[model samples]
Target: MESEVSRKVDFSIIRYAQCWEDPEILLEVLDIKEGDVCMSIASAGENTFAMLVKNPGKIIGIDLNPVQLRLVELKKAAFLALEYEEMLEFLGFSESRRRKEYYGKLKDYLLGETEKYWNENMALIEAGVINTGRFDNFFQIFRKKVLSLIHSQKRVAELLEKKNKEERYEFYNKKWNNLRWKILFRIFFSKFIVGKLGRDPRLFDYADNTSLSAVMSEKAKYAFTELDVSENPYIEYILTGKYTKNLPFAMRKENFQKIKSNLNRLELHNVSIEKYLETSEETIDKFNLSDIFEYISSEKYKELLEKIYEFSSNGAVLAYWNMMVPRSRPEELGNKIISLSETAKNLHAIDKTFFYSGFVVERIVK
Candidate 1:
């Protein structure tokens, strides 16, 4: 497999503090239970925290990016060191004038590397770690510069308040969705801009066959017209800078005690998925690999899948998403893999974060 260092130019930076996919839908499909040893990509650690609520026997999170692993460690430390309200304040969910002092307290619970990382990125903590990453920065530009010009804050908030799908569709079509909106949306999320600002340019090759702008437009339409935006934190954060009533499961108040109690269940590894799979002798019962396949070549993806198949236990379920780029198991492995395409389709219909073009779940039959 290609190393992330050679593949992504922005590997060192914090690319995402909050993941784009909805973990609620993901966990529904995951159907995790006790005694399950799960494997996941530690993107922002949101899904990992969600998995902990399931009371799994073990969860091994792997990430090639050190910054991403640091974020997870910081969160784990917050749970160990701070009270619920104080944890929220330190995590940027609420305001705190003494974040530095709070960090001083939290650092004792963190590893030396993780503490140093947060110490170096104190500005990010002060500004709200949720909105500080590069991907968030890209969205900030669009929200402030383009989206703000197209619609007023009240109008945008109103779009979230519609009672039903009919009401939403009517409001979106009549007031929000216009030629100007389409033109600006296309320009802002076009391949040229997203490739540079959001993700690496090399990943664009896999999505060359599809229209990136159209996928984005369709996703935007679904978020506005079909899904309930009242609790969709992804959209809430993108439009406004905060999560009011609804936050990710990891950050929610009720789940804090559960996460804190089960903190020992989660283990973090600063390594690639392939590396972890190769070294890990335990069979993974559930796999939550985000869109990592989108970044690699088809051959590399196939190789990685083969490794995953080897690491996974029989009947093990796996879930992943297709952002603009699409990927699937090689034809040669069809007999060993059972596709959950229909379930994926049904779940995709109600996906709160309509960012991904496709959602796929499969099981190992062999």
Candidate 2:
């Protein structure tokens, strides 16, 4: 039977055009060794492709939404068919008037359904695929409407300027964190507004009664002041419509060729994680379970962990984010799974995707 969360959230459309989590934190926590077998949630395929840069023996990307799987397939095809610059332009990272032409080159590489999907959505192709998702559109609206009310273009550019921690804090305190910014940010990001405009309300099924805006407001402040804004592609994307400076780990030029060369190691599956694990034959070495537990109940979360443990090799590591609802290795499963709390904490401190409340890493002991 489909879960309530699954049934309620629309899966027919692209929810996220790009993976929002920081692959840097993921790589640091997983510490993938060459030849490691990794399993990751395929949300827009960014992190999965990023994992390939590590030369993993194989990467299995599983997602419940076939639309998301198609997005991954399209990106993989882009890497295989286009040059680095062409791929960036084709994916909407860089300016290009020739994206449709580039897509023509990639047509042969795409699966039948994926080709048909893209062919039907040429407007998205023209606008840039990275900016086409519901979540991405939400950010676009914020940038155009909400953000302009709070700061001018010059102020936004100044916020991205390279600065030391002390200087950044001073700038934020004196110039950025004004009354208007706080009131507008909270109103835009409140649970009700976010559910309607940014994400599916069903996604918050397991979230507590805490104020979403309050938590997110503090997180935004941390990303702006404590983190290096110049080096954070996420901040760059949120403030600007595209990546103007640093790119994500997978999209960076230094790692592009490496990921392209290892494309054969990547695999995609359209199914739930529990379903995939139940039928899978491979023993996974690392798991990038990206914030999926936030939508499900605690009992369901523990049950899924138990299923994952059955297919995990001894000493295998699992990493996931807690955006709102808190979840971790259940105490009853302590004998089999050990929480790497300290490492998770250390990595979370530097996580560029600052909206998540917690990042959890665990290992299978048996």
Candidate 3:
């Protein structure tokens, strides 16, 4: 028999350094207000910073992975210790040969653990923290090796310049969409590979068995052929390994001062959402769970939803993504957990990153 330690999954390492969700849709659905305390899962901490723009009283970002929370702390430290442009360089959003020196400057701002963590993993920091994680590394490989083979840099830039939707669709059909694109994409981004590298393997247990390649192909076609890829920062970042004009609010230069001013209001916790909720006495005004439900089990999801309901105040909004897995509140809890499926659907339609099968929004009734 396997030892308990060997059998248990360890999630303390870095999972994602960049968020894949569309913060625009989330902010629109949440409509966060002043004096509201928000709870969010700190997957790369992108949405956490996005949520801060609304001037919420507090935003607590909790993650099962300590390394992920460390990244969040490093981001906060960047704002505290560096200027707008310097912050970009320090976070690995831009090229800089002095990143190690910058890290040294910001070391005082980080917690003892966060500073020590960075010191130990200096190689990741030197390479650029935003580009070193499993998910980011996978995307980098996909972009450089897979995407570069099919579409030349000039061709992709030209496609983004196309304004007319009909013209873009025609261009994609004629110049881009083909059997080769589909086949290679499927082989590289398959569920087996994604689970092993991009996400936890158990997350795929409840994920749809249907061809992920097909699902991804459709999403890719929609993003590239139908939607304006220029405005979709997630796609742009995945393709180029960095953001230009379009970026998450956290990384944008204009928002840097605002984030720095409000950095004190944000808190980072290295704990599972369920564990945090069970121990905390705070009445959460909003919850951003991300796609964590897909990673756990149906029963676990139900149990956590119940805990969320218990901890929520009136008008508390909850948001999460349903990737390949389909998860919903049990009918027994329907009276308490009111479905905002229609609202979620509207947001999903306009989501910049159309990777997930569904985006779920719900409210706990008073």
Q: For candidate 3, list the clashing residue pairs, or say none.
A: none
Give the TM-scores of the predictions, in the order they appear.
Answer: 0.96, 0.98, 0.95
Question: What is the TM-score of candidate 3?
Answer: 0.95
lDDT value for model 1: 0.83
Model 1: per-residue Cα lDDT at residue 67: 88
lDDT of 1 by residue, 1-366 (tens): 545434555568888877778888789999998989999889888788888999999999988888888988888888889899888888877777877777788857877878778888889888767777788788988888989889899988887673687888889889999888999999988888987787767766666567788899989898887887776777887887777757876788889999899989999988788777777789999999988888877888888888888988899998999987788777798998888889999998988778889999889987
lDDT of 2: 0.91
Model 2 residue-pair collision total: 0
List candidate 3 stretches off by more than 4 Å: 1-8
Ranking by lDDT: 2, 1, 3
Ranking by TM-score: 2, 1, 3
The numbered model that scores best in lDDT is: 2
Q: How far is candidate 2 from the true structure (C-alpha RMSD, Å)?
A: 1.1
lDDT of 3 at 361: 92
Summarize candidate 2's per-residue lDDT along 76-109 as a digit string, tens digits. Answer: 9999999999999999999999999999999779
